[model samples]
Target: MKKRNKFFTKKNGFICAFLAPGILLFLVIYAYPLVNIFATSFCRWNYKNFQAPEFLGWGHLFDNYIKMFTLDANFKMALINTVKWVVLTMVIQIPFTLLVALVLAKKPRGWKFTRNMFIIPNIISTAAIGLIFLNIYNPSRGIITEICNKINPGSNVSVLADGNYAFWGVTFAFILFGGSSCLLLLTQIFSIDPGIYEAAKVDGASAWQIDRKIILPLMRPMIGTVSIMAANYGLLLYNEIALITGGGPDNATFSLSYYIYRTALGSTKLNFARGNTAGVIQFILGILLVGCINKAFRTDQGD
Candidate 1:
C-alpha cells in the first residue's frame, strides 16, 4: 500500500512537471490578457493618458457601453452589420458547405479532384483572397464591370464604390468559400459506420432518403461545430473589408473586428476603454453563440 502511494506521488509529480509550462504559458499569454481587457473596459485609457487606465467612478462605470449604444453611430452600424453577417453565415455558408460535403461524400467521378479544387481557396491566405476580390471589384478593369457592360452597353458597375454594393461585395468575398468547413463535415460523414450504409441500402433506402434520415441526423454535431466556426468568422470579419471596401463608401460594412481596430489603434481618435468594452461584448457574444449552437444540436447529449 505504501509503495503504491509513493509511486502515485512520483507519477503525479511528473505529470505536474509536464503540465507546468503549459499552465504558465496560458496564464501569461491568454488568461492575463483576458483579465486585463475585461478590467480595463471600465476605465479611461487612451492617447491622452498613455501611462495607465483611470477608473471611471462607480456611478459612471458603464459610460463607455452607454455611449456605444446611445451616441456612437459607428458602433451601432458595426454591431448591426456584424449580426447580419453572422446570420448570413448560418443561412448561406453552412448550407452551401454541407451540400458540397454531401456531394463529395458520394465520391463522384473526379470527386477527389473537385474536393482539392474546392479547398484551394481555403488554403490561400485571407489577405490574398481579399486582394483578388479587390481587383475583381475594380470599376474600370474588373471582371464584374466588364460583364455588366457586356449585358448593358455603356453600363459602369462599380461594386466597391457604392454602399450597398460594397457590403455585399465584402460578403461574397468570404461567404461561399467554406472548403475547410466542408472538409470537417466530410470527415464526420466518413467516420459513420459503413455497416449502417450497407444496412440502409439493404433496407431499400433511396439515396435521398438515406441522406435525409441518417446522414443529416448524424452530421448534426459537426454541423453545429462548423456553424460556430463560420459564424465566428463572420463575426470577426476584418481582412476582406479592409482590402475590398475599407469599411465602405460610407462606413456601411464595418464589422465588430474592424470597429475594434479603428477605435483602439487605427484611427487618430483612439478610445482604448471603449474598444476594450467592445472586445468584452464580442467575447460574450461568442460564448453565447457557442452555447446556442451546442444546444440546438444537442451536442452535450451523448450519442
Candidate 2:
C-alpha cells in the first residue's frame, strides 16, 4: 500500500508539473489582468491619482457607468459606430467571404491563383494596410484626389476630411478584406465528402441546388464560428481607425477599443478607471454576442 501510494503521488506530481506552466501563463496573462481591470473600473484612477486608485463610495459607485451612457457624447458616438461596424461585418463581410469561398470551391480557371491573391492582404500586416489606405485617401498626392480632379478638374476632395465620407472610408479600408474568413469557409466547403456531392449530382441536383440544399445547412456551425470572429474584430476595432482617421472629423469613427485607448492612455487626462469600465462593458457585450450567435446556430438533433 505504501509503494502504491508513492507511485500514485509521483504520477500526480508529474502531471501537475506538466500543467503548471500553462496554468501559470493563463493566470498571469489572462486571469490576473481581467480581475485587475474589473477592480480598477470601480475606482477613481486617473492621471491625478496615478499610483493608486481611490475607491468610489457606494452612493457614487455607478458614476462612471452612468457618465459613459449619459454625459459622454464621444462614448455615445463610439458605441453607435462600434455597433455599425459589428452589423456591417455580419451583413456584408461574412456573406461576401462565403460567396467567394463557394466560387473558389468550384475550382474554375485560375482559381488557385485567385485564392492565393485573395489571401495576400490578410497575410500583410494591418499597419501596412492602414498606411496604404491613408495614402490612398490623401487629398494632395493620392489617387482619390487625382480621380476627383479627373471627374471635375481642379477638385481636391479629401476623402478623410469630411465626416460622412470619413466613416465610409474607414469602413472600406478594412471591410473588403475578408481573406481569413474566406479561408475558414473554404476549408468547411472542402471538408464535405465527395460522395455527398456525387450523390447529389446523381439525384439530378444542379450546383446551386447542391449548395443550397446540402452545403449551406452543413456549413452553419462554421458560418457561426466565422461570424463570431468577424463580429469580434468589428467590435474591438482600433488599429485601422487609429491609423487612418485617428477618430477625427468630429470624432465620427471612434470604436469601443479606440475609446478605451483614448481614455486610458492616448488622452492627456488618462482616466484609467473609465477605460477599464469600458473594457468591462466590452467584455460583457462580447459574451452576450457569443451566446446569441451560438443559440442561433445550434442544431436540433432529434433522436
Candidate 3:
C-alpha cells in the first residue's frame, strides 16, 4: 500500500509540474489584473494629489452607474451610438459580404479580378485609411473638390465638418474595408455539395427559389457567427473616432471604450479609482454581452 501510494503521488506531481507554467501565466496575465481591478473599483483614490485608496464597497459602481443615466448626456450618446455601430456593421457587412462571395464563388473571370481589387482597401491599415479620408474630406485643393471641378468647382460641401456627416464619416471605411468576410463565406459556399443544386434544378426550382430555400438557410450559422463577432468588434470602437474627429466637433463620437481610455489616461482627469471602476464594469459587461451573443447563436451550431 505504501509503494502504491508513492507511485500515485509521483504521477500527480508530474501532472502538476506540467500544469504549473500555464496556470502561473494565466494568473499573471489575466487573473491577477482582474482581481486587482475588482478590488480597486470600490476604492476612493485620485492620482492628481496622491490619496491613499480607501475601500468604499460598491460606491464607485453606484456613482458611475447613476451618472450614466442622470448627469452625463455623453453616456447616453455612447450607448445609442454603440447600438448603431453594432447593428449597422452586422446588418450591412454580412449580407453584403455574402452577396459578394456568392458572385466570386460563381467563378467568372470578371468576378475574380473584381473580388481581388475590392480587398485593396482592407490591406491598408486603419490609420492610413483614416488619413486618406481626412484628406479627401479637405475643403480646398482636395481630390473631392478637384473632381467636382469637372461638373462645378463651386460645391461648398466639406463632408467631414458637419456633426451628422462626421458620424457617418467614421463608418465610411467600414463600407469598403475588405473582401475578407466574402472570402471566408466563399470557401464555405465552395464546400457545399453541387448535387444539392442539381437536385433543386431537377425539381424545376428557379435560381431564386434555390437560393431562398437552400443557400440562405444553409448560411444561417455562418451569418450568426459573423454578426456576434461584428458586435464584439463594435464594442472596441475607438480608432475611427480618434482618427477622424477625435470624438469631436463636440463629444458626439465618444464611444464607451474611448471614454474609459480617455478617463484613465487623460492628463486633466487622472482618477485611478474611477478608471478601475470603469474597467471592472467593462469586464462584466463584456462577459455578459459575449455570453448573450453566444447563447443566441448556439442553437444553429448543433449541426
Among these predictions, the greatest lDDT belongs to 1
User: What C-alpha lDDT, on a 0 to 100 scale, does residue 243 get in candidate 3?
Assistant: 77
Across 1-303, the per-residue lDDT of candidate 3 in tens digits comes to 998788778779899999999999999999998897777666666675445767766535466455545776766676677667767776777677777777677687788777777777767787887787777767784575566666776766665677777777777756545376666677677788988788999989987787778877777666666666666667667777777777765777777676666666764766666666667666776677667767765534434
Error of 1 at 299 (Å): 1.2
**Model 2 TM-score?**
0.92
Q: Which stretches of candidate 2 lie above 4 Å from their native place?
A: 1-8, 152-155, 299-303
Residue 117 C-alpha lDDT in model 1: 85
Expressed as tens digits, the lDDT of each residue in 78-196 for candidate 1 is 99999999999999999999999999999999888888888999998999999999999998768999999989978798998888888899999999999889989999999999788
Cα lDDT tens digits for candidate 2, 212-264: 88999999989988888888989999989999999988998899999999999
Q: Return the TM-score for each candidate structure.
A: 0.92, 0.92, 0.82
Name the Cα RMSD for model 2: 3.0
Q: In order, what lDDT does every prediction score?
A: 0.90, 0.90, 0.70
After superposition, the stretches of candidate 3 with alpha carbons farther than 4 Å from their true spots are 1-18, 49-52, 57-61, 110-113, 117-120, 144-155, 299-303
